[model samples]
Every structure is written in structure tokens, then in C-alpha cells.
Target: MNQQALSAFIWSVADLLRGDYKQADYGKVILPFTVLRRIDCVLAPTKQAVLAEFEAKLAAGVNPDPFLFRKAGQTFYNTSKLDMRTLIGDPDNIAANLYAYIQGFSEDVRDIFERFEFATQIDRLAKAKLLYQVTEKFARVDLHPDKVSNMQMGQIFEELIRRFSELSNETAGEHFTPREVIRLMVNLLFVEDDDILSKPGVVRTIYDPTAGTGGMLSIADEYIIEHNDKARLVMNGQELNPESYAICKADMLIKGQDVSNITFGNTLSEDGHADAKFDYMLSNPPFGVEWKKVEKDIRAEHEQKGFNGRFGPGLPRVSDGSLLFLMHLISKMRPAADGGSRFAIVLNGSPLFTGGAGSGESEIRRYVLENDLLEAIIALPTDMFYNTAISTYVWVLSNRKPAHRKGKTQLIDGTLFWQKMRKSLGSKRKEIGDADIVTLTRLFGNFTEAQIATLFDANGKEVGRRMVHKGEFQPLPPEGGKIKLAPLSRIFPNDAFGYRTITVERPLRDEQGNIVVGTRGKAKGQPQADSALRDTENVPLSESVANYFAREVLPHAKDAWVDEEKTKVGYEIPFNRHFYVFQSPRPLEQIDSDLKQVTGRILQMIGELSA
Candidate 1:
């Protein structure tokens, strides 16, 4: 069945939840039941064989796990004789039978249901006398692996969560990303490695610290498989939310993947894959979320472990921990002597230029740029997320930069690439369509300077667009139309985003107008800084501190001298500043004419009213 019809059919189960449960509470019943039914259908084909093997193994007093797995031909097995269809046989005691069936599954499968709190839903449904109906509604549908591929199942899962999110006015973005965005990121993550990834039987590993339904990992896996059927991508992820974690684990389990790779915990406080390294990683961590809860553990490591720990460079403000995840991903990068690694992460604008020089955020940016870890940063369209309408950016980094790309970072402006969605989902009113994704990928892959020309009619509505590579002739508009040519891609030196925030201080003077000199050891003969006149200025890393002081500061204060001890090197990606274009105001005659016309219209209205 198509996704819409399938989601609609699954949602029909909620019809039984009305009156007995709040609209927001519907997911608690629907999500778990849907997963249970899918699992039930998958285990049904070998149910009889698995149960017989279990009985025979028990009679012989041997471990049934291996035998049961062999009989089921899957990683997990349910040994109970009762299935969903069988549970429906006893409507009066269906709840008890359902519990037994769940308990009989292997530990991994059982853990999925446990994380979903399926037992509580069973008790609640049974208490409300809706247990049998809900079970029957779910059982009637067939979610066999043969009928529904893993991809379609994932879409159904997303649709269900989106519906629940819309009903409760919550953001599904917190649980998972919109797939188009994931596709674009995955494209960029693998764009530079076509040669290595296209080989048959090639094996690679992918990780996501903020797994969030494992959407990123699954998409990366899909990309690799589509790349080469023989190529394999091992997936690993960790999620903090119980429900998202359950959905993620269940999806992985059904795909014949090693579900143990997907873990559950706060990655910051507890490293789930402590010693694991990966060839590629992707994450859409909770943007602007606080790391205060794990501050103690993270701070201890930053101080104690230094460069040996994940947060070695520095820590961002506790209020927003987005940078922390970047550091963690960096730690997980395979050594350059090895195959090395590449990663993409979605972050809000804050990380680009929040903290000042010498601060944690600035230091993190400094470390990244100074070390040339950043590869490219793509600016996404605003309102593209389900939660907030704020602008977001995708940062792609790698330790093993191509020879030509060394010491350079590419920035692709994708803010204008989105198309309006036919239907809005929560805060998400726009989406990056396939065409947009291709354009973005091309811009990054080309890694050359380019501009996009937007044609607008006299009415000022956009009518056409085209990309012009550097040195190419710009596209022109039709008669009576105007064209806007803006830079679509730009490459910059790594140090372009680096600067030194120097503290400029003036000399202290006594009431008699004499400079006050310090009497202490270090400052004995030096002029005492006037605290009131102290200020700071960011000097570009390309310019020497003394030269900046001489050119910009000395003219205003002749006595000003550099405080070399207080100088601090910092970095920030002023993304918008690099692309800003100035527009001149209208001429005086034009302004006067427009005001006169408006005044004439007001006088005409007044005369008509009087008449």
C-alpha cells in the first residue's frame, strides 16, 4: 500500500482511542502497537518451527537461544505458541495473552517493547475495555517484510510521528529530521569519496551521536547500498529519548542489522561507543539545547583528559551544546594515517559567531579552522525545520582534505533553494526538494566560485533562475524584467574566519595630567591602563596586531599601546557578512514624488467624504 493509505489505516486505530485517551496520548498506544504488529508479522512465518525447537531444546535441557534463532532464521525469535491472530481468539483475556507473547521474544526484541512501555499501554487499553479492539485493528493489517520494504516502513514511522507531533503542537524535528535535509547532508558527506565507495564488497562504518530514529544512519546506509549492492555500511547510533530510541532500534532490528550497534543514553555523559571509530558520521543534534545536566562529567573530561578526550579543544556555553557534538564526532574520526573520516552536522547560527575571542565557543571555532578541519558549510533555507523558523546551517568537516581543497573552506548559500510545501507541518512550511538538493550538492562538489541569477518581472515576483560559474556571462532577464545576480558559492582561506580580539587600553593619568606608571614587578615602568578607556577590537588574522593598532587605534589615541599579554586569537564564520550587498536609497526627487502622490490620494479621499 502507498504511504498515505498505510498511515491512514494505521491512524484508524486511534479512532478507538477517543474518549478513553487524550489526543496527545494517542501515539503512546499507536506507535508501540504498530511496532508490535510489524514484529508479529515478521516472526509469524517461523513461529511454529521456533516453538517446536524451543520445546525440544527444553526437553533436552539445552540452551534454546541458538536453536531457536536457527529455526526462526532471524536474529530474534518469539517461542510463544500464541500469535496476534491467536491472541484475538480470547477477547476477554487478550491483554494477558499479549503480555505473554511479548515476554517470549528474544531480549533485543523484548527491549524494544519495554522502551516503548507497551505493557503500560496494554494495561491502560485493557482497563478502558478497548484492548481487544485495538489489537484486532492492528492485527488485520499486514506489515510483513516481503510486502513492505524497510524504506516504506521507515516512511510510515515518520508519518505517524509527524501526525502525533502536529496534534500536540510539538516539533517532530526534535525526534528526527525531514528526509530531504538528510539526503542533502548524506550527499555532501559522501561527495568527496566516490572512488573509494564505488568498489564492490567495500565495507564502511557510519555513526550518529544523536540518532533520532536513526534516520541519518539509515539514509547513509541506503546511499551506500544504492552505490554498490556488494558494498556494506555498518550503522551505529545513540539516542537519549526513549521513544525515538525504541523506534530507531526496532527499525534497525527488522533490517537484519546488528541492533546492538544502536545504544540508548546521553552521549555526553556516557560515551556509548567509547573506543569505536567510523569512516562517516551524521547528526542533527538538539539545536540550542543546554548541556548543563552533563556539565560536571564533560567539564571533568575537558580538564582532566585535555586533548585525549572528546572535548579537548574547548567547550561552548552550557546554554547551547551543539559544538560539543562536533567535538565528539571529531574524536570519533579515524586517524588520517588510517582511512580518515568525514561528517556533517546541522547547527543553528549561534555556533558560527556566538562567543567572543578566548571564550569557549570562539576557541572551538579557532581550533577547527586553525587545524583546517572544516571543509564546507551550507546555509539552508529558513523555516525548513519542523520546530523553529530560525536559519540553520550544515557544517561538513574532514581530517583528510583533498590536495586541491587544502587550506580552503567552501560556503554554499542554499537559503533560496527551497520550494513552499503544499501543506505545512508544524513550524515546517518549506522543504528542500530533490532539484534543490542536486543544486546544493553540485555547488559543494564543484567547489568553485559561482553566482545565481534570479529573474523577476516588473511586478517583482521571481520568474526564473540560473547558475553562472565564475568568468561566465551573467544571465539576463526578458524585456521589462530585472535580474539579480548573487554569489551562490564562495571559497575562502581557512584563516579568513580567524582573528585576534585585542584589548586596547589607554594610559591612566593623575589629576595633574601626568601619566601614572605602575610600581609593581611586571608593570614597574609601564603606564597604568586607564580602566575607563579600556576596549576591545577584533583584528583580522591576516593583519598584524601592531599594524592594526597603528592604523586604526593610534590615530584616535596617540598614547595607546598594545597589551601583547592580553591579545587572544579567535575565529568566527561571518557567513552573511561575506555575502552582504549594499543597496542605495531612492533619490530625493523620487522620494518627494512618491510622498506627493500619497498626499494627493489622501486629499482626494477627504474631498469625496466631504461631498
Candidate 2:
């Protein structure tokens, strides 16, 4: 069946089950059924071949591994006594047959999911007859090997999870990272590096601490495969949520991914993979979640051997311990002893400049900044995710930066970037187009700062341009006078430069003893005439000389201003520096005579024209 028809059928099943369960809870039913159906479909074509091969080995008195019954290239395993065609061939005993089918799969595909947690939950399906109906409903539409590629199946799974996340809103932010956001993160982190793509058999491990659905890791894997045929990607992750953990494990199995290290349990409290490090790590941990209630052993382990020293600035605030996960990921960074690593994480704005002054969070920021490990921080637009519409940022950290980027951080204000997809879900939220993604990725790859611009004020005036320069203001002088220096600004509404203004207001007394005043004074504590302006009335004439003298005069003439008693005569170079204006070899007298003759000729020409 076409994708639309298939999706409509599956969504109907999920919709039916959703009435009895939470919106988020629908994934528990739909995801597993979808996985089983696909696996069964794939196995059906090869079922006879697999059984004959098993019988041949048995007849030869040679028993191969039972797990080989579901080999990588096989259509499906011959585990159940009744496959979809026979069980659904008669719908009465469908539930009982489906239960048997699942058991058969558990036994046949043991090695594939030997370490997964789904085995514990599969028994619960026996009580829910609706699940069998859903499975039978899924059976009607074939998701077989020839009908759907593994990637297409993955897409369907991702879309269902995304829809569930949208409908439920409970695990909306925690369970899924939007595909566009994941694409942007992957592009920005890898578009420039030839190291990951150019080398064949170069094993680069991709990891996520909270690998909800394993979308981020899988997408990155696909991206690498697209670029290089021989690129080897090893995906590893640690997930705390059981349903999502189970779904991720099932996905790897269907895709034929080696998920030896995809582990369950809280990554922060009891990391499932402590000794392993990765070359590329990407994640979107649950925002504003706390895990400080970790067991004392975990805390002691952290203090003794984990990231306590790295995050020693301060323990994160008790309410939201998001940074704890980031620190854990950083601790697992590929040591320089191994090949270097890079990481990209999506976070809210709080981490950028939160914690007030010198807070533990601030210390963390300071350490990261001073060490120059922060490569770039891209601020995504608002309402980009399915959950809360809070603004987010992508923090890109690299242990090995190119020489030019050392000791500096690139802050990409991508909040303004992105184009809305034609079929947008709602306001301030949209999918980024290919052009948008390309532009953003290129900007990130080139580390270009030219496109950076600032927002305007309430009046729409650009802040950077209109905000007065506070360096120093040069005060206007009286007619033909020298320029003067002004002090720094100390009040609002000061001139272009940050200066203080004082208004003077005085009353005029009338002859009748009534005050008819024209009020005036320096605008509140304005400076009296500056003492440096020795004589305010004696203004300098030459403009250039005035400018030069204002800048160069004071420091050079500090000790030269010898005051004898009250009236002092300065015996320094008082010659006007303006003489250089006429210092040419040709005299002005000859030039003026020539100008007079030319003026006479012009006057004669005007008289002739009048006549």
C-alpha cells in the first residue's frame, strides 16, 4: 500500500487505543505493533527457506545457532505456528495466535534483542485483545521487505512518535527532537569536517545520553552514509524512559544496527556505559528536569572519579539540574589520547547567561569560555519544538578547534533564520526548507559573522547606531574658537555622548515686586566654566591648530605652563601652527595678482555679453 493509505490505517488503530490510554501512552501500543508487523512481514518471504535450512542442519546432525533463524538478509523468522496469512486468515483466534507469534519471535530473534527490556513488557499484551486487533489491522497493510525500505520504516516510526508527542504533550519535549532541528544540528556539526567522511572503516561513534527514539543518532548515521559509502557509524545511547528505550532498541533491530551499547537506566544517576567515550555526541535532554536525588553511591562516585572536579564550580540549582547531564556528556568526551571529539546540544537560553553573577552556572560558563572549548552558540527561533514554545540554543563544543577559532567564540544568532514549511502546524513554528538549512549550515561552516544584525528599539531605531558613543564628546567652541573636551555622561538625556546636563531657571523681579521671570540655569548641577578653559572669551582661530592643540597641548605643556605670581607670560612656542597653510615656494602675492587679472577678464566677458 502507498504510505498515505498505510499511515491512515495505523493512525486509526492508534486513535482507537488512545481513548483507553493517554496520548503519549498510544506509542506503547502502536510502536511495538508496528515493529512486530514489519518484522513479521520481512520474515514471511524467507520463512520457508529459513525452516528448510534449519531442517537440513538438523538432518546433518549439526545444530546452528537458533538466532540464525532471523539472519540479516532473511525475509522473516519462522517462529510462530501461524504467520499473519494463516492467523488473520481466520480472525476468531487472532489474539491467541498473535500471543504465540510474539513468543515465537522472542525465541527465534533472541540474540537480536538479548539485552533489550521489551521482553519484560511483551507479556502484558496478552491481556489486551485490542492489541491483537491492531496487529491484525496492521497485517492487512503490508510493510514487507520489498514494499518498504528500512529507512522508510524508520521514517514512519519517527513520524508516529512525533505525532504522539504532539498529541500527548506530556513527554513532548523529552521524547522527541524535531527532525528539522536534528538536521540543522547534524549539518552544523559535520558539514565542515572531512575527517569523519573521508576515511573508510574510520569508526566514529555517535551517542546521545537521552536517546529518545534514537532519532538524533540515526539521522547523523544516515547523513554520514549519504556522504561516504564506507563510513562506519557506531550508535550508542543511554535512555531512562522505558517505553522510549524499548522503542529505540526495536528500531535498531529492524534497521540491522549493532546496538550492543544502547542501554537502559538513568544516565545521570547510574550511567549504563561509564567506561565508553564517543567521537560525536548529540542530545536533547529533558529541559528543567532534576536528578540530584541520585543515590549516595553515584554522588560519591562522581566526587571520587566522575565530573565533580570538572563541574566543581558549584552544584547546579536543585530545581533544574539540566547542566548535570551536560557535564556528564563532557566527562565522556573523547580524551586527546584517543582521537578528539565534538558535541552539539540543544538547550534553553537560561544556561547561556543565567545564575546571576558568579553563580555556579556562571562559573561553568566562565570556565568553558576561558578554556575556549565553546565553538559556537546558535539561538534557534521560538516555537520550534512540539512541546513548549520556549526559545532554545544549540551549544557546539569542540576539543580541537582550527587555529583561527582559538581563544574566541562564535555566537550565531539563528533566531532570525528558518523558513516556514508550506503546511505549518501553527504560529511561530515551522519546518526549515532546504535553502534555509543550506544557508545556515554554510554560515556555520564558514563561521561567517557578516550576516549578524541587531534588533531595533521600541521606536524602531537601531540600538547600536543610535546608542551614543560614551568614549568622550568634543564640545563646540565659540566663533573661531578651539575645540574643548567634555566629561563623561552622568545623567539621562545627555547629548550624543554620555554627558550630564543642568538647566538654569531664575526669576526676573518686576517693579511692582511681582516676579515675571525667564527661568534659566545650567540643567541641574551643570559644570561651572571649566578651569581648563583659562579664558573663555579668548577663542582660538585656526580650526586644525585648535584640534591639534586640544589633543596634544596639555600633556606636552604640563610643566611648560609656568605661572609667575598671577599674570603669567608663557615663553613657549606660541607661534601659530597655521603658518604651514601658506608655506609653498610660490608667494601668495604673485598668486593674488594672477587672480586679479583673471577676474578682470571674467568681468569684461560679462560686459560684452550684456552689450
Cα displacement (Å) at residue 488, model 1: 0.9
**Candidate 2 lDDT by residue in tens digits, 1-611:** 66656666788886567556666667667776677677777777667666666666667888644534454253225544577667777666666666566666644244333333344334444455464566567778788858976666666776777677677666436777778889989987787679777888777888899897788888898899898868878889988776677667766766666656788888877777777778888989887765557745445664676444334444567656667766767777887667667888988766754563345565556556555567776767777876767878788887777776766565555555666666654232666666667766765676544323233445545443111123433333333333222111111110111111111122333579554433356324322222343421112221233344446544644422212123211111111121112323669899999999999999999999999
What TM-score does each of the candidates earn?
0.97, 0.68
The TM-score obtained by model 2 is 0.68
Candidate 1 residue pairs that clash: none
- lDDT of each prediction vs. the true structure? 0.90, 0.62
Worst 10 residues of 2 by lDDT: 492-501
For residue 245, model 2's alpha carbon misses the true position, in angstroms, by 1.7
lDDT of 1 at 359: 93
- Model 1 has an lDDT value of 0.90
